[model samples]
Target: MGRRARARRQQQQQQQQRGEEDGGRAGGRRGAGWDGGYPEIVKENKLFEHYYQELGIVPDGEWDQFMGALREPLPATLRITGYKSHAKEILHCLKNKYFKELEDLEVDGQKVDVPQPLSWYPEELAWHTNLSRKILRKSPQLEKFHQFLVSETESGNISRQEAVSMIPPLLLNAHPHHKILDMCAAPGSKTTQLIEMLHADMTVPFPEGFVIANDVDNKRCYLLVHQAKRLGSPCIMVVNHDASCIPRLCIDVDGRKETLFYDRILCDVPCSGDGTMRKNIDVWKKWSTLNSLQLHGLQLRIATRGAEQLVPGGRMVYSTCSLNPIEDEAVIAALLEKSEGALELVDVSSELPGLRWMPGLSHWKVMTKDGQWFAEWGDVPHSRHTQIRPTMFPPSDPEKLRAMHLERCLRILPHHQNTGGFFVAVFVKKAAMPWNRRAPKPQGGTGEPRTCVQPSPAEPTAAPQEATGPSEPDPEPGMPDAGVSASPESAESDGARRDGVCGPPPSKKMKVFGFKEDPFVFIPEDDPLFPPIQKFYALDPSFPRMNLLTRTTEGKKRQLYMVSKELRNVLLNNSEKMKVINTGIKVWCRNNSGEEFDCAFRLAQEGIYTLYPFINSRIINVSIEDVKVLLTQENPFFRKLSSETHRQAKEMRGQTRYAAPSCCVAGGGRRPCGPSCPRTNDCTTCA
Candidate 1:
């Protein structure tokens, strides 16, 4: 065979072996090729093929290539956190150290493709590798690179994400002072990206804006918290709520209560994740028209709710992992119709240059599960109307279709970019929705009070357990399988309509479910804890002392967290109305052994960056060699250190921290300290 044929055969053999070794067993029956396991999942579904074929989304002569790409395993992709000072350093290390080693490496006689920088991602921070995740783990040649990825990912310096999944956040154009919301954020890859964008300028100790990440499943909210905690951002808040009915919250604006509308909203709503089939093999077996048909109403509801909660000039990016029009363009069309011109689709063709995508379809047909097709809503029989709604079909009026500008939306296919399919539609709010044209009334006005039953004092205030393994397989950003009814009554019900009204009066009691979170108790400015910490660290007087808070009310405060002044305002005003699961970054922890040092609280690595700017004293600068020794050795005596470091260590009387200049560690002088120890008075490094 020729070289190309040999490589293709080798790939097929590896795939066959993987299926035999990993496929789940069925009935424990041993057969000639079964090994007591189930047959390999056939990556073919007649219904799926027929449905898409009818949609005619694939370009001419590309149907076979599209199917082939979908069948192949997805390549691994990762993104370096661009806001960090060490981003360039990480990129350099990957290029010179790890990828260079793999230049001549081969696995099972198949040459491995060197990882390349994604052309669209700025600064060469994002990368694409042809190596499958399984090969990265099993191939001895790639072991070192795999370990590097693991370490960096855990440290929040990098993220292993799907390439298409990174597109929505980039389109958001988040800023440090923009109030943003992730309507269905979980397994928070996109949410962390937003946090990174918010802290793009590290000089600002605390950004004026915050991100509120919400999800309906209470348990999944904890997973979202765990992922967000890695970034150590105090401005991000986790809330448990049905996105379609998320309560409108109030925030203090210039000493007056105002309805809180997000400056940017990411409405990546739940959908049938047919686009993620390349990675999630189960999607092939479960793919059907019913999934999208059942989810269209909920998707529309979430998108409408997002538009309602967005500022007049704000932008909302509605995205989905499913390429099905029922879940992509159909929901966008319904939302725009409901808005009555309050929202308009934005043409982002020039946003991410070099990206491969097709314009959203202005004409498409919806199909029932039993091979029934409808070109218009009126074609559906009365009995099938409950399952298929008018919004699921394309508009019959050519003028209306042109006005919707559905073609502005983006649809990325697997073949064009060697990536999983994705859909993104950007909407910019031009005015308030038709139903919510009036300004929000002040609190305690005609609106009924929105409150939840308070948790008892005995409830434990412990943090959620840390994620043990790699991020749990989240359904492509916002793929929830629950709440999939698409009946017309449910879509047009008064409850759903009221949810679209900005700051509407509570139509019904808001039920609070899941574990009750500990109350956020703000520290009094005169609290005894502040005096010693301020004096010992020589903190600048400009710090907002009152922004410090603890989760406990009565017990000794063991950890001190600080939020931006903006987040504090949101928490104080909406605590009763919103289901806040967790917020705040731990800035200080009580050190029982440090009582003699005149300060009981020591700096926490999680919040060192935010606190570093305000600390004017007790900082000991060390050399790069000193940092290496400190990290390598448990206890290195002063004699082993350089002359200057030794002298500085001797001069310090109490517990001391060491820091190396950013330039010495990462070749970046934008910050004073290294990435691992941005600011510290002791030998312990910051994350």
Candidate 2:
């Protein structure tokens, strides 16, 4: 047999062996790497023919190669989240242990190296496996590698999904102080990345910057919470909001109601996802030209909202998984035209080194499936069909179009990076967007409260106990995600009016967060309760005493929580501007009488890292042996602490009872409590 035929036989035979030996077993079809059943037989739809024909114009000779590459599954890729406690250590283990097992692995007689990190990714945190996941699981030598993925992902040490999905976060270049917004964050792979970057400086308990992760679908926000909880960053606030009409929020800073804005925004809008043909093999059959046509307005509106919310000089990344120019360059072109020089496509040529990419198309045409060609917007069928915007068409003046510089946008073809096709366009807000003069504020909107959607907190399931079982639901960037929203056909119809222009209605009135009174009411500085706990923990009086608040929720919020002054400003100032879903961290808690300390406020485990440096007393170190015992205890109390711990606890006695400090070993260093930490070791507890 020839090389191709022999390779096919080898692949099939190995698959058969795997099915027999481990098919229904640990790493099988119903396994961690397996994304549901085998990929469906997807074929091109006729409706998408003209769409491809138009894409062919700018791509020139590369069109055939691009289309052919999407036929196969994308290589699995994941990035270790930054600002995580065990990030570097986990990366070390992967390189040495898990990846080492794949050193001698081969599939279809093709030698496959262990998962390799992205050359452009800093610190080698992002990794890519050259082969599709199916082949990887079938290979005998790579079994342990597969098991590693299942385990590590469940433990939140790794995220497994698609390669191209990792691009937008890298482009955002989040910092420790930049307040960020994820407009359509769901199954929050990128949201988690942004959270990590927000805390990348490793500042604990709080970040000067915060991430407001929002999704249109209220149900999918649960998935987003699941993803966000893994990072353990207290700075994230998940909300449900429609991207296009997300309400404006304001903070009263210096007696001015400053509009709540983000230093960076990620608008990974909903798309038809034709570029996802690799893993979502069904896209081939489901592909339709109308998918982009219907979604163009939504994408345009979402990106525009993102721009409006962005600070001047702030950057917003507009991305889509579809390869269609209508969804990619066309929407960007629309936003630029409407921005009136306030938005510019940023050239990120040097951003991700060693990344193979093509520039965005400067020229393309719009064609209907009916073989009708629109030479220009004027030629579009206004009466026969809905009017299409000028931005949807490549401008008649080539110079003007070239000046738009859409080429700065990055396009990742599957063959170029062994990844799925993706389009990413970065725009910097050069100046405040000139609001349309025709747009009017909602009636009764002045100084009146609007409706609100209040959702109960989303409690995520505990981390996976074993790695080699059903694949955890922790989807990284890439692959089909949870339900994003309604379908495209209905989306267009719901979004359009008699003119067929799509625009979701804004809030009928200004949003009021149902605040008759401030919740973060300040406790007097000299309150009787402050001396015992304050003296014991040695808290700085300089810390904003007013930002601390007590709440009734005892589960996760505990009894006492502290919001950073910056974050508190946003929360208080924007009470009428938008719906604030969830915010703040459990910095301190009121302990029951049974706890080790009678003090009402013991430093919460999540907030300890950030608060520890500020605290002056009530800290005791124990041996590693004691640490293990504290972590493993069941009664939520560490009764076996050394003399150092007992003496420290006695200093802050108040309604005292022993309780879990949640202190557990992390990075072989004394770290904050984890979920697995029973909060038993109260030694680190600031009572």
Candidate 3:
């Protein structure tokens, strides 16, 4: 390139960074260059510089390098979708076939490999390229690699977003049998990961525990379903609610209903998102001191609510796509201070084997265009317009403050990992947060602190009227104290069915799934449709909370879903409180064919994974070759199958990539590239 051309480009970028006109290079869209295509390197934002200097965290010597990294496009990184059947083979295929195109490349006299596996990720399923996707699009050496991504991403075998986005899911430590909640899930890559973790322990499709993925946006909740649907987790229940005021919920244990709580919560809140400058190029031009400052209050409330919803000793990971102090450490500090000893930060350096990260800074600053907002115009009414909160600023005594534990938080900067910048803080609820009681007022009158009233063994919230169910003594001695029922009647009573605690912000939108019907109702055991279907699949009658059916948002066929006992109780208890966008995986679809095994009720692909363990019959095992053929065909029916295999095959012939068992089940679900199904007895080995 000519020197003049480079100089002109640099000058244009500087003007854009200063919030000057971008002349038409960057357009008005956020991540303008990154919507399904390559993103341009970013420019320097001056206010961002002033804000970073105030924090005094970055070393002065490396400051320029840190600043420069944000402007550079992030390296392309992709992870094997963990639960997919062909995940391992796809990983091998990339290294052996596509990546082989760029072998032995030389850059500045140094030999460079194509893609290197991220050692931190399990089984080295993740990879990173030194070159950015934007450059790769134009590079001749990696043409096959780029084409591989294009093909696999469309096939749902790969996710092609920024790599730093993958960090939170890794740190979440989700697992089967653990009730998990993802507050603010959308454009849901992380939620998908959570679902994978929920199903990770399953040899069959069903998991004992399930994921309750909540997002405020109704539309985005559907998107989350689409992303989560790829892995075919039947255990996922997608709901929409404001994270700050999410309602307390209940679930049925054994045969009785009780209040619900989560074992794990992910509070990945929305922020200024300047850390995404590498991918969202518009951040370079739109960056301002007020971005994080304005969002501090909302972020704090979301984190606080997540803490409230967590079970005692449950871990909640708070994260953001922002590098700003207010959004990262300050929000966590404020939550810790408000918890008053109920929360403790977990040191997680040793968690992900080889993950490299920096500790969160104990010290940070609150800055605005006119210097510190709190120290300057904080008392002014106009400052409230910027949504600045008192908790956003540093504490008077840093050690006496919750900010002291900030050192345990993880900060991922662009330069440190060749990815986007991110901040993650894991907190364990040591005890129930003392809500409803006002602390001694602080120096200035700020907005009201967090308030929640829910009953638990440790902290009883508002005492709810006893639900009407079968009268039975508590099964275990301490079960009653923990709100576990001995056994509910056949179902909850009609009169007590609608009981709930009043909480949560008023729903902005009027539409909700299963709002008209009592959402808590389980599928009746006597339902003629379910018995035949259960018998066809050889299911143990009590397998999942199959009786608990909530109408999902995809109500086109009036799709009825089955949720975990805990999730059902939550939906029932929190009904009419927060908006319920969608929940549960559909187990029974609208069908009237009445063919016994395949008619009147079709097993949803989403439900099949969790259903695998409970099913005692009707699952026909196919060879690896058969699995591959089924996965590749849109409407595959095999004549080569045994009669038993043919019976199930015809039933699943027109369905999504479901029903067929690979060496293991995977959907974005696909067939295995290796050996035949490993499930014993349940699958006939295509004999």
Candidate 4:
């Protein structure tokens, strides 16, 4: 019998022996029968144990400890938003207020350990707590702390994420000037981290960088939108697309069209998620070797596409939550071989000082679900050839295997650090891919004279022509091409071609799926809506007027949003090529009562930080006590304020706006308001 079958038989024998011992000790009591009311123990999975045992992934004499750690529940972890100016204040509150109260508290006869900072995470912004979610909800001693977490999470001041999931973004090392992309970003916790890294300086209201977060599921794209909205960043754009075939977008640079390449890419592909078994109990029953086998192709495709779009010398991190070598080292080896020296694995052992991890495996065996093992591709039977591919095996040449440096990949295990298992491999692009190294023909009469036409907002732009370099070698029979076409030609083609230089022949474009969003309409520079607001606020001349846009085409615009100059270039050029789910930050909201104040648009809380620097006049500075009263009581009379503050408020004749420091209003759910006359019809409008 194979190893798996024998292991299962042995497990059954042990269970039977234990049952007999228990029955004899009970003296055949009626309540102790086999069918008695009792919950079944669910911690065992013979096949899971057997599969790992064969691989020998656990160190000598540590297998029992490894299995023990997987059976325990995962602890709760949270991260404070580091880019915000009030992040220090929130951390202070967590340490001094909440941690101090829980010092001597015990729940359900268990002592609760004080939460500690994740040493690897910078600035002590992240914490690890022994208390699980169930205890946090039911324990009266932690009630106030629980409320604090809920409030801060809702306000986007903090995030609760798995500790290991936060590693990829930090390893990405994003900067304010780099263009980043998050492939398969859904329920976006890591995407928010990328946003925080881009805004690390905090003083720059609008950064040059932007993040394009893409997910295959249409519904999950909204989750990304919700997360980005909480951070209130203008540089984030959520799009819906299959990461394996995400389109090549073009941008206008110096009046010339150029393909857009990212400086950093996060390819966190989907896997069997055996590492998450601690928190997601269902994985214990659902995991199988077949899952990694099926997902190998899709994962490689996504990583390859990300590499193709990365600029030379740029970095891309490929990560998964599975410990299976078939999904981790095997995939990285295949990608390295395909790159042909254009990509290399980066050694990041010293990046995270306190992180505990093992080097990636250089050797592993492949097994079928039926307990059939394959030492090499030649060992597979002809009937099973279709199920297994050569790329799934390690390189046969020992020297070539050593040269690839597969050991540079980091494998994080749960037993080492009370966290989920994760595999991360950072790659740096040395040159263009073999197939994409063709020299471009110069524009303007290099070939036949062709008219350059701009596509309308309603029409899709023509797809770019496939580049032709030296013929590439054929891949294995079942292996897919690394550079897959983003949009394929429709079957019913009319045989029309827009000049050969423009793109492919006329064909039906890929159909955009999901809810159709409102078109982004930029207001005219001379629009009638700008003069009054500009004069009232004394706006600076350097303010970008064309970047302000409304969602509606022709109506009383309810909300006006703003995007950075770099993002505006992308939106204007590639609106037809990409499926943008949401972008822009709300900067102005229409208030009907504001007509009496000579301006109909009022400041929005979501974007006050972005607009605060451009306003040259009509500013009010209030003290901390005044801010407390404004937050506690809605629309208090000016007479209640201190003398100096009352005089400043009375000097403003029309409707007034209030701006508070970030620390004072970080998690406070109150909205500040101006003093209003009792006889007025609107409470927000000043007399």
Candidate 5:
């Protein structure tokens, strides 16, 4: 409060501004500082500028302040109706503060005992280990500062909206045994969320659910794999294919059609991504009303594909982070138009936990291609274009299909709720179509029987495959075993099995062959080259071809080219202080080190070499080009180790510690709150 102190503070602020302009930027984009550029175009766009103003934020000054305004205190209570036993665990976490007397709350006009907020005592909120997660507590607001902390914690501050979008997994009402699909999933948050939902809590082991998280981009498909493992979910399968082509009628060995219907499906499809303004400011720079107008076609295509895969009365939540009506209401409207009343939007405001929202527009007018409201409103004078005018609601008639009723669709407004805008519409297929109504006939012109059509990966099938059971072997020798060996060489050699791994070896039988006989395979406690893993094999005999690429790297310089469930687990579960030496892996290098390149550069292989920069651990797949570049690229590091030592060093660094520095940091950071001269001050190394 002294004059000298205030003057010093002001001087420091000015210097900080100069440093920012002079390139003292530190850390990767995720660090708690500027991502170091002008506020993203998306953040500065005309529309987004207004959004910031509505939130009482000054757009130009502080970007984080603009974002923090979007955060609101989440409701403390989550109602669980059917699963009382499961509800108890949720209640237990909230028992102490707001609902200590669980019995006082009445549901359906009857008194029910609800669990209360649990205590929030933990040494730390640990990650990357199999150790059980401590239940976070519900502490009361004690002081002015303490109230802020509690508010931040309860507002889901532990997660970003990108992470929050994936919470659908935690809200599962379906059985864990059901099969699920994340249609149009990429940059995969929702897919990972589903994995978390189906996966057992810390108290349970090996959850009974399964998921096939697929994406059209072969590159993005691998991301689904990484996210699945990071979230600690084993009950998931990542497929690199289009969603619309998911096969419909896969037949088992018994000649029975594969009825792979899913109890739950997530259609978190592609959109304009307007809701990501806080994180992806680039979108704002290129923001256009036209882009959203075009995405409506793809969004509908992906959603309809998801619906075709849902079991009767099964739940599929269609969602997008974009606030544009075209990506939300219009797409849902189109799907309902095509379903012939077979698919009905399910009310989700009452179904989900955390927050409530207003339903989607039941009736909406589409703007004409010429840029005027089309229906009864007709043409507008050119002079009127500059003026903002609201269109009148169209008159009802017995003729055209009524505006697809979407009272079930829900929208989240950033201004109204102080949260990123989002739209969600949950749809359920009706119990049964009228018996008198017959499906359309196939293209031939005769009095012939109709045939069952198989669904494509993009079409969304409704059947969930169970682990196959043993039966009479096929008349053809060895037709019974599938996925017995994952190596390409072995699949090629086994004439007995349809899928084979081929190598030059003349006398290689099978490595393992009891898949149908036994779904569970055990590994010894002390296995060297391979770590222990729980593999869930798909049992649908007629499903699309699923294969794995596994091999040992051979060269004068020895290396390993294998990616497995076991190795992924090891990196995800261990953390000790370690140093990161970059390996040219693209995913690990995003927004890093000044060099940027498209990951799609290599197509000859299915994977890449990943060096755990921290531990020197190496992972191999289709190509190690990126990892090689990352490791060899010049930085401040000096290479003093032997070639062999270098290989080992690179492999060790490929572990999780090298991947997620934020999660691995202790007490978060070493530097003091204010600036000090690293040249003069004693800098504590991260190690």
Candidate 6:
């Protein structure tokens, strides 16, 4: 056979061996790499297109291995605390829920395990059981995969290593009411996860609390905001800041060292990212023996900073996506050395099963004071001696003096479970931490940074002159200062009307919709909330017109008043009576007396998505029923006009002489099947 065929055969043979070994076992028995059940394009990058064409996957399964590799085990050490204390309650819940395997296990002590290897994370397993304390619930997904775990949980089968992702939320509950600091939180998966955990518990002991998620880059802060918003948690505060200065944020309250103390902190620092090679193929391309050692200094600084932020007895978790000893053990060693006996690596082996890895190193080497090399690889006497060899910390050094200053610590890695490579080291401040005893809170004397609230109704214009009538002369020719309102006479002439009928020239009013607080709709100083351009409108039917809002008088009030400018120059102008609203962050309008209406909103991009409510509108986060009612009511004549237009268009298109009326060509010709044309059967054609 050729090389490719031989490799394929070997892969198949290995998979077959693993399948036979784990065939009858429950809870997703692990044997080897991937079984043949997975797509073949996943194994080789160059063959992606071949497999995609044959098997039907886009990009030929580009991220196949990165995503698929999560199933593989990593040597990890998991430590679980809260679960052990709640083991009995968990067992009872599982038993009552009809989980026979859980009911059969021993639950007398801190933990209870089945003879079967746990398919779920020990923490998540505990949480699932805890949630079931009140009812018998079976997860259909988990139950379908691993029959041995909890014949019930098979239906809920998520990957086991994903449990590492759940730790923040679970711990957040166990330690609700405590301040949190997530150092190096970017692309904030863990930060948002923590917020979600806190949201899970409504009656947290402490009502006033927030988590500070910090990273070195401003761009990352924006990304963090996006993640936090999606999780919809109110407690997150994204900060673009450095981690090394965290200790300086510690403050003194009375003498107890209470200010700026976090109950839980996570230091998922940057590293060579070796452990994550499964998902991050770039790491494999970029990997080098020197990278981990290079990042060691930065890692140590961040870990030390986390230690400094911990409250007396508070806990911190330092983690990374790299598996190198320099990035993991060496950094922890440096932290302990700098701490001077204030931190301790706690024994976590008992807390989590399937995570029995090595402890922090001690007794490693450094350059001797006599300028002599300690390792056998050292020292060309005088010629090459000019170049300094890298120094090392003790392999078994516990930094006992440094550890004596704190309460606890633990570590986690991926090799222990078939998941992306990762590492974590947990530490706790002593009940009376020894670091600077007291420092100022990071917020400074200015008080905590408050969110920029949109101006309230009562706080209309900052200056009365800014909200005054537009009676002033034009100071700079055609310039109109921002806050002036439109003339009452002009408002009456416009066919577009809101609220009641037009009153006298001086008393005419413009009423805004969906306002809970303010009945009077008027602009003050140029409202930053309003978009620059307003939609056009016309009273006459079938006449096209466009309108632009421009300052009529110069001064502060010029920001408020605007006159609708007609656009007779442009053909088929959208003549809609547009009202821009502050809420909904969008502009709503309807053509002159026409039922068909359009709503527009600006996205992160400068471009806009103008939605036709009358069409099969694809709106989000709102009920379709409610949308239908709102659209129909706002555009009373929309249905009649839309149906007539649709029928006319169809009739025009069906006429062969017209060659299908082209919306783009206007005069009618065959529509070109350009880049967006439907080559395949699955295309959803749009005009």
Q: In terms of lDDT, which candidate is strongest?
A: 1
- Residue clash pairs of candidate 1: 656-681, 656-682, 657-681, 657-682
Compared with the true structure, model 3 gives a TM-score of 0.72
lDDT (CA) per prediction: 0.77, 0.65, 0.63, 0.75, 0.40, 0.39
Higher-ranked by TM-score: 1 or 3: 1
Model 1 alpha-carbon miss at residue 439, Å: 9.8
Which 10-residue window of candidate 3 scores lowest in summed lDDT? 468-477
Error of 6 at 48 (Å): 27
132-151: candidate 6 lDDT, tens digit per residue: 21122244422422332332
Which one wins by TM-score: 2 or 3? Answer: 2
lDDT tens per residue, model 4, 168-187: 99999999999999999998
Q: On residues 35-85, what C-alpha lDDT tens digit does candidate 5 reach at each position?
A: 656432323565544432433323245556544543322222222211112
| Model 2 lDDT per residue over 77-158, tens place | 8877656666888789888877777788667787776777888778888888765667767876567667766666764667
Q: Identify the superior model by lDDT, candidate 3 or candidate 6.
A: 3
Candidate numbers, best TM-score first, in rank order: 1, 4, 2, 3, 5, 6
State the weakest 10-residue window (summed lDDT) of model 6: 566-575
- For residue 118, model 6's alpha carbon misses the true position, in angstroms, by 6.9
Pick the winner on TM-score between candidates 2 and 6.
2
Q: Give the winner by TM-score: 3 or 4.
A: 4
lDDT per residue as tens, model 3, 1-687: 899999999998887785434434575444254465566544867777877776765665778788878777677777777676667778888878777766876545656557888778888778887765545656566666677677666546777656767778778787788889888989888887787787665464556677878887767887887777666555677776667666666555564444466889999998999888887888888888777766777787778777767788788999998888878887877778777787899888888877677788776555665664444234546636445556766566746664457778888877766778888998887876766222334223442222222222222211222211111111211122322222233123323443332122333334343222223345555656566555555677667644346432223334556666555556555553445555565555554443433444555544554565665554445554665655454344456544655665566544423344321222222222222222211122312
lDDT of 2 at 398: 74
Better of 1 and 2 by lDDT: 1
